[model samples]
Target: MHPSIPGTTPDTSSTTARSHPKHLKRFIIGSVAVLSITGLVAGGAFAVQSAADSRERVAATRALTDSTGLQRDQLGAYAGIAEAHTDKTASSTLAEANQVLASTEGKADASALTAVSSSLASFESMPIDLVVELTIETQTETAALSAAAAEADRVAAEAAAEAAAAAEAARQATLATTNTPAGAKAFAQSLASSNYGWGSDQFSCLNQLWQKESNWNYQAYNSSGATGIPQALPGSKMASAGNDWATNAATQVTWGLGYIKESRYGTPCAAWAHSQANNWY
Candidate 1:
């Protein structure tokens, strides 16, 4: 049995309220823990800032390089970070990096230096470590590409040279074994009788003196400037036949016929190819 109060009716609700109070106390403890955690986190961040501010630029660079040094890519990244800090004098990050890379010497580690330069070149924008890795990879690839292109160019140039030499040799051989003026008459006569191309027209006017003197001597130079079988006064007048017209009959005939055609249409039927092929008429 319960003991009864003297005046107020005994309130059973008070017991219920007391029972819930423990849960409220637990919530207060949890809030306090969250506040403590937040304070610790903020304090830690301040400490890190103070530590960073205490180091010199060179020391900072060394630290970065040391941390990432073990990683193939990370070392390069650290090197870049060092470079970025190296240019303390420059206004921009990259400019500052440039300054360090330029001024750092015996104290500077070459591998680290290279990594810094390589990484810096690769970045449009990025953290120093990643920039360095990108730079190293890109430089290696670019060098390889350049070497391949140079090799290809060398091969192409050699082939072109060989081709030019072959063409020159053939041209010299043609000149060495060309038909003489004496041979021209017999060849022309035979061709004339046997439908000598182009309507078999009479080139008799051109054939008159050539039959006796040069006989179609393309190399017939009077050195005195009397040139070709037709022997035009100036010798150079027959140059239309070939650039070697003065020394080559094939050249002279080419020029003579060209003169006749351009000045006289096809009435004489002098063609550049026919003259070269048959030697003359």
Candidate 2:
């Protein structure tokens, strides 16, 4: 054993100093590991925050774009609804175009709105009233023309009907004349010769007169009470010839010849001349 010296802590401090290096190394290593872990956790947290921020920014941008699209779509729908008016109020078209311009608001750019406004102005500047009036006038004129054409067609149809009726009447007259009895001419000739002293020269005149009056039909009747081949006024006047005057051509001819000879018309030719001038003998 060694005796202690006063006021001297001896070399104990040196031994402690030599031993402290290992503890210091261990503490530094532990501190470095803790700092590394803290750095890694901070980096991960920063990355997560950045990603969240980026997503939020994208969502915000998309929301803004969608809002703009919705605004534009609503504007277009309003414009479409306003554009379907016509008739006498054609100026409503300009009103609708103006509405389209008003609907653009914040959704469209200034240039786009200006273009739409210009179009509306141009539409409003046009003479819509004049166009409507002109259209009405044109329609009126067209209707007048159509009516005139229809009238012309009606007139043409009426004229054609009248002509057809006249032709049918002429055909009936011809048929009646062709149906004359074979003995009618001979009977007329015999009666004219015996009673009126008329020869073959008067035969033609008698034939023309009888044909014009009754188509040589003994039973023929006229609206004026005239009847038989001579178309005598009052069919009963032919009864002087015979009771069968209406049915017999010979009886009708005998009575007619006697009447011509006794009256102012002394011959068939004179009676025919009178009939030609006055449509009656």
TM-score of each: 0.47, 0.36
Stretches of candidate 2 off by over 4 Å are 1-179
Q: How well is each residue in 1-281 modelled by candidate 2, as lDDT tens digits?
A: 22323422122221222233432221111111201110122212321223333344345434543755544335334333333222324445334434544553343333433443343344323333333443344444334444554666688799999999999898566445433655677767776777667789999898898889888887788788999888888989889888877766777877888898889988889999999999999
Expressed as tens digits, the lDDT of each residue in 11-91 for candidate 1 is 222222223343222111111110101011221232111222223322443554475455334544444455555323122
Which 10 residues in a row give candidate 2 its minimum summed lDDT?
30-39
- Quick one: best lDDT, which candidate? 2
Q: List lDDT for all candidates, in order.
A: 0.46, 0.57
Query: What TM-score number comes out for model 2?
Result: 0.36
Q: Quick one: best TM-score, which candidate?
A: 1
Q: Can you tell me which runs of candidate 1 are displaced by over 4 Å? A: 1-122, 182-197, 203-205, 222-224, 262-281
